[model samples]
Target: MSFTCSDCGKGFTRSSSLQRHQSVHTGERPFTCSVCGKGFTRSSHLQAHQSIHTGQKPFTCSYCGKGFTGSTDLLAHQSVHTGEKPFSCSDCGKGFSRSFSLQRHQRVHTGERPFTCSMCGKGFTRSGSLQTHLRFHTGEWPFTCSDCGKRFTRSSDLLAHQLVHTGKMLFSCSDCGKGFTRSFSLQRHQSVHTGEKPFTCSVCGKGFARSSHLQTHQSVHTGGKLFTRSDCGKGFTGSTDLLTHKRVHTGETV
Candidate 1:
């Protein structure tokens, strides 16, 4: 007998197939992996899951030594070497390595917020993205480094921190052949070669590649007009500012 999905008019020959199909609707994954204890609804998923256990990044690039778990991931990683973006969105001409990334990128245009935070009123287009943001408020550093006791809020942060000890530079430039600790740092480091200042301040005509630098530049306005005391050379704005400023004179810096 065939198992019929009463909810969607879809039918499957096997009960196991029907059960696995239903999980997609309910967003439920009951099948658990023994190695990582990660759960998946499909057996093929469990097969693909095993690669992470062996650290088998067999998918190697022709141009770079960077390896990836899946072939598609290798293709994604290759785009960095050639700057060749094949997956272009028809909606925005915004390219991505995978179709899912293009779909996610489309959300920036449509302003769709599918994932909502239960603890707060905030929303996000992606569940993983919302998970990263929720970590900020909880002060929970779930990702830990095996080398060091340092903890980070995001997996990417932990990965970057690990580079300090591992000395493995995956992303490198073809022009200069210089490697960087993190991808963002490499992107910034490339600006020196290309002379690109993407981040700009609205307050002043001055521009910077990093937002933190722009923020510090904005403080220049508030940084000035600060009243400082003589001899100790303390600075403040108002009476309350002066009072709190007294804490430094009271040997708080020590």
Candidate 2:
């Protein structure tokens, strides 16, 4: 004999299971976790939720010795070691180990940023990334270095900055072999080798390797003198020209 749900016409082997299933339709969750106050329909579901707060993972992977809260999660972790990418993106054909990961990656192609910041109205692909970005607006630096007491918003940024204290430069330019603390600096160095001048002046249509150089060059067309001589009250367009003019009074060799 099977217990049936009148609301959804679903049959259950036990009356208790049918009663638990009915809670899904009624949105009634009796079992609640004390730690997080999260409600669940079944006691077993509430037990699993408690494990997240307790940091208790009972299931262990046989291959890599990785721990998970459930046997299904343990099986999922094992797929990474096996190099099994079962889930694939329909738009770009990119493979992922998990179906949820693939669904998240698909949002990149769809331009669907579900996670949004309430303060700035900025959208992010992941909720965790948005949470980290919120630290910038709140001026919260949680991660701190024990060595210098330097603070950072994320743990990854703190780890990278710690390499500076050790005098370690992992990123290097291929052309000049000059090392840099960050990959963004190494990429900018590589542009010099390729002779790539991305920044340009709008008024004169002049190109420059950097935005700062372009900004300085734009001052030439502004018809305003920024540098002034204190002795003669003479004005110059650039600081270098004013410094050269002051050499007449200082008696310095040019």
Candidate 3:
């Protein structure tokens, strides 16, 4: 007695579930936000969105004291404290706290790029990645640091930059007592002790500790100088190398 979606052939236990699922294929959004005029397929989605205008967050996380408009968001946030990853990737066996994160990670294995940039036509696995890529073309730096007035495209970059102003080294390496502003930096630093060169060049079979190093090394094989200086017409394999070379003209000390 299960109801099936005619559009996608998806089975649902209830007829109401099938009707709601049909909206995905039909592009039907019966519920509309009064404030922003945003369309939603479900009334619950509209109600959750209305919180943005009303500034109401009833659901609060007990672990972090973070407020969310919906219970589902709070439940997902709670996983951070519990360290529970309910969703697991079938291809890589990597666990993600959110199902959407798991879905995005699956694209790495499948090589599926659904989101494409309208200006450059560059494909991305996630919509957020495409949005960030579009920012480069638009020259939009939305996130700004309050202290130094430094601007960044993403909020995470801004947060990491803020650590520089505070002079806070939260992550430390156990191997050499080296401190890092970010956890990722600490992880990369720890690789030096382990001698782990995970990123390998397909052309030369040379391994690198970081992916950026491997990308730069690949340019040597292709004889491509992607980053070029305008003042001296000096070409470099990597952006960092070109940036370092620019200091000679600027007379800036590192």
Candidate 4:
């Protein structure tokens, strides 16, 4: 594919560079690796692949003293230490660990269901995220807790639940010393420090950690009557809450 350079009308020799230059026309990842079956858009990435096999960590961060195989990875890691989130969600003020994560999250706002589940009508922005969600309906427990032997569908969920037992707060906010098990929890906790209630109630000004929480809060303002047990007069926000609350009365723990 011979093409004229937009800069000086000079013709480029290689077709691959021409395609990458025209990723301006359509974003494409043509270059692929045989070993890991990973795809890349450029030859430089294929060369970078050698570092993973060679176990060569060339980049070192001064702040956190972390090593990375690539300088780009090191730079991205440094962003975590600096708390510099350049990319943000347009729909919500929620921040992300990386720009790619922010981009993936934007799909949630746009309702762009690109990654559809093969098993069901469900769709997601990222493939791995969809894979994680599928485990819930499938009743598949791949990760089990060592302490209590309680199984979890997703690795992150298992990790978070393990914290309940171990009390391991890995993610902590610098502004406030409040620590959380997961990065997401720490992020939500930071909102408390900043007094930034990003997600507000549509019916009321009440803010919550999640949209579901906001919905539950709205139900209260709407004066929506929640169902109570026939035998018990105990109140609950929803059926799920009522079911869980019933467990307490029944002396059941899962």
Evaluated with lDDT, which candidate comes out highest?
3
TM-score of each: 0.53, 0.41, 0.55, 0.50
lDDT of all predictions: 0.67, 0.72, 0.76, 0.65
> Which residue runs does candidate 4 get wrong by more than 4 Å?
1-62, 66-74, 83-97, 108-123, 163-166, 174-176, 193-208, 211-252
Cand. 3 Cα-lDDT: 0.76
- lDDT pick, better of 1 and 2: 2
Q: Which stretches of candidate 2 lie over 4 Å from their true place?
A: 1-57, 68-73, 145-254
Model 3 alpha-carbon miss at residue 26, Å: 21
lDDT of 2 by residue, 95-165 (tens): 87778789777765565665666754555666556667666556577778889888777655776888988
For model 1, the superposed segments whose C-alpha errors exceed 4 Å read 1-53, 81-83, 137-139, 167-180, 184-254
Which model, 1 or 4, shows the larger TM-score?
A: 1
- What is the full ranking by lDDT, best candidate first? 3, 2, 1, 4
Clash number by candidate, in order: 0, 0, 0, 1
Instruction: Please write out the lDDT profile of model 1 over residues 137-202, one tens digit for every residue.
Output: 455676678986777766567778788898889679767999876776887788888887755666
State, as a TM-score between 0 and 1, how close model 2 is to the true structure. Answer: 0.41
Better of 1 and 3 by lDDT: 3
lDDT of 4: 0.65
Measured over all alpha carbons after superposition, the RMSD of each candidate to the real structure, in angstroms, is: 10.7, 16.0, 7.2, 9.9
